[model samples]
Target chain A: MSPARLFQGGLVVVAAALAVYPFFGTGYGVRALLQLFMWIALAGSWNLISGLTGYVSFGHVAFFGAGAYTAAILITNAGWSWPLACAAAGVAACGLALLIGYPCLRLKGPYFAIAMLGLNEVLRALVSYFEGLTGGGSGLSLPTLQASVPIYYVMGLCAAAVTALTYVIITSRFGLRLMTIREDEVAAEAMGIDTARHKLYAFLLSAVGPGIVGGLAARDQGYIEPISVFPLATTITMIVMVLFGGKGTVWGPVLGAVILFVSQEVVWARFPYVHQLLFGAIIVAVVLLMPRGVLGILQIKYRLPRTV
Target chain B: MNVVITPAMIAQVVISGLLSGTLYAMVALGLALIFGVMRVINIAHGPMLMLGAYVTFFLYSAFGVNPYLTLPASMAVLFVLGMLLERTLVFRVVDAPELSSLLLTFGISIALVNLAQLAFTSDLRAVEFLTGSFVIGPVAVSKPRIVAFAFAAIITAAAFLFLRNTKLGKAIRATSQSRDVAMVCGINVGRIHLITFGFAAALAAAGGTLIAVIVAIQPEMGQIWTFKSFLVIVLGGAGNYPGALVGGMLLGLIEQLASLFLTTQLSEAVAYVLLVLVLLIRPTGILGGRST
Candidate 1:
């Protein structure tokens, strides 16, 4: 195999080893690992649209919530299998994302971000309003003693697939077009890059991974609520991860998710106040000190040139 | 059960919404002031307001200071905080891409909210002000709300006067109109920016303190107000103080009236819908002429 292919193969092996870590580590470690995988998926999908396209969507949690709620409602009401429910949930999320993104994406910059935030609140309100279906704020519960192992494995696979998809897209011509649009939409459109079509495609593709993870999350937790599933914290954490890792890079958000989740768990357990304080301080400091993130610092240290 | 909707109820909703909208306007006034002068959307305005409430909460809890009295103290403190933020964080990103500013402010917001939550947990707290009532013909209004409304109006008016009459305010207005021209006229644009940001933050602090009295105070309270303030800014016109007042009152009325017909759950959504409609139809907003 070529050197690049060999390197990629080796990286995959390492990642796979990391994925099976719950089998060897403590139960707590397993839980943390599961959370890390979930966050990694979230951050990676977020990077697709916000980091790469520079759209800065503040409402991605809506899709995730949709997926979770869809899966939960379907499984409980229709008695569908978990996998089928997961697929259906993902499809439902993608459809919703498309519907929300079409009209909203026409706006640019902070306007888009505000619209997304509003959309998320709107969705949350709607979910709560339809109390008969969603169980409102009290939440819905999944079947007991189902299968945690299968969910973990699915999460691992989903994270890997998402990372691979991101890598592929970043290397392809579409990635270049996206980068161009991010740099300057007017300029990109002048160059015949249909910015809207590309953005929709990225937004739609980005929704799929989060949807799948949300489904897995619902299955694993065996309970879903509008608050837990569609927490604004989810959006903030994903943004922090992608931002702390370096926005447009593939490995950046993954590294971010791993480091942030681990640190959060450690700090949250000891001196919760200090941890929370540090959490906010870290975001502000990182944005001000290292706009490119930890990976960006590493890139500079290693004298690695930026891709875009 | 058919409930008769009376004129008294309509009057109450209108008065309450107007009061609430005034608070929203106070918050939006700060945002608009900063945006007007600096052309930077201070996303952290909400957090600063939250901080004000927290400060007020602590002052009252620890030393038994009246929350109303804490308004000036909080304003002064937040003003300094604003100055420091502008000089250090916002100044650096002033010339960066719009997205960078957005991200930077967002980071500041996250940091502030989390820091407040860490310090004050997530418990909801309220400052009990006046518990009495005022008679208006057959309609009786709570004294604190009326007082809060008066406080908002007075502060808003004072802010307008300060902006119009003071030397520093004139310099700020000059800078807002054109930074290059203001600099040519020997106006210290940097100082103008610093003072403007501080003034904005002070406005937010005052509003936050009053709002704390009127409603519950929590770390995330600012998040809701932030968006609502944004709606007010858009509705009123970003830079115009008068626009903020009118916009705030309009939003309050809409929300209160809507809540009477619809559920309280959907009450908040009305602001967003109005915002979207305004943005689509009139990007310049109701007051118009202010730059985004």
Candidate 2:
């Protein structure tokens, strides 16, 4: 068999193992893997726009929070089922992205980043102010569901779907245009690429996985709050994960999410007091030493596949 | 719910707003100086300001030192800290994409905030140097606030004078205009960058020390000031000093008036709404024709 085929077969085996692990594994093990899958989905979504297009959004949490809120409101206020509400959450987030992305994508560099940051704060305030609907700062609780196994399966599926979509994007002409924009947007426009339209599309695509994952997370937690759903730390973690693994590559976010999530879990269990500080140091070190990330380094040093 | 709108109430809000506005201008001025000179956004500005407040709090609590006297010490400490950071971390990313400096400073900010939490707990601290409020025609002004505003105004004026007249300040402005030209003109651009960052940090420290006496100080309190500073600079125009002052005052007045009509949380959103409006309508800011 060809080396690529062998690698593909190995991946299939790993996926199979992950798919059935919940049946035999301890509850703690299942919960841990579920969280891992969620991070992979979230990081993959972030990587779709930011890593691919080099448009670093500082408030990607807006989408997550929006999705979570949508799902929660739909479940409690409208008496919708979890599956339908989660799908609606993704649609709501996409609508938000399209609306905001049109004007915000016009901004370049720090301006765009700062605008996104302001966007998160604005959305958070708006959610908090609508006390009748959102329960204000006290947060909202959904009906309890004894369905961790189902959640785990759904989250795993979402992660796999995002990874597959990323692979498809990486291999498509659309992704080429995004790479061109990342390299030199003016040059891309000169080459007849609709930079604005393309960026908006990428931004829209990127909001979906996070939105669905957020809905799932809200359901899993059985409670939702603006602060919990819209935390800046979530964006930071996703950004760090993508950067740490290797941005602009198909498999980088997956690798990064797995490694960083496991490390975080281990460190949190051992030294909860110093976890945040240590994480900060890790971020600084990552920026300074591995700006291109681990996959980037391997690709350069060992002639690994560029997309992978 | 027929609330009366009195002239005295308006006057009181306006006076307090302008007072806080002066301090806001100082913080924005610091941010303007750094971005103007280096083209790098210092996300850690808030954390540095927090450190300055912590410094003042510790000095006042430990040695019974006057909070005003601790201003110079805070400024000096942050100046050295800023210079060291510029030399070590910021300089490396000076020419990288704006994202690099932003993320780098963000990392520094996280580290600093968490370190502060570990060392000084998250409890709020305040300096009660002046407790009385003097009434002038139904507009009562707190003594400490008045003092802070006075210092803010004087320091801002002094900063303008330095930029307008001094040799080092000229070099700094020269670098801001065109780094290559400044270098060709025999100016040490690196040294100017170093001094610009340190000077900016010192200004933020001054604002921190002054405001520490008026409000409760905490490790996370700097985040709001950072947002406020960004709003002021955005409204004023990046790197425009006079524009920043005007913008800061406008924001202060707007916030004070907003609280009258909306909840405090919604009032806080006013800055963000104003920010979005400014960005969409006038990206060059209210003071037009400035290049970002």
Residue-level lDDT tens digits of model 2 in B1-292 = 3557899989988998899888889888888888888888788888889999999999999999999999899999999999999998888888886657877887888788889999999999988898889899889999998999999999898988898789998888888888999999999999999998999899889988998998899988777666778889888987777788988898988888888788877887898878777877887778865532
Among these predictions, the greatest DockQ belongs to: 2
lDDT of 2 at A272: 66
TM-score of each: 0.91, 0.96
Off by over 4 Å in 2: B1-4
Q: How far is B89's C-alpha from truth in model 2 (Å)?
A: 0.6
On the 0 to 100 scale, the lDDT of residue B14 in model 2 is 96
What tens digits encode model 1's per-residue C-alpha lDDT throughout A186-214?
Answer: 99989998888898889998898888788
Per-residue accuracy of model 2 over A1-308 as CA lDDT, tens digit each: 97679979999999999988988999999999999999999999988888888887777888889999999999999999998999999999999888777766776656666667667877889899999999989999999888789999999999999989999988899999998888888899999999988988999999998888889899999999989999878887888888889888888899999999998887666876676676677667777888878888988997877767
Can you give the lDDT of residue A179 in candidate 2? 88
Model 1 CA deviation exceeding 4 Å by range: A1-3, A15-31, A119-121, A192-197, A266-268, A300-308, B1-6, B62-64, B239-241, B289-292
Quickly count the clashes in candidate 2: 0
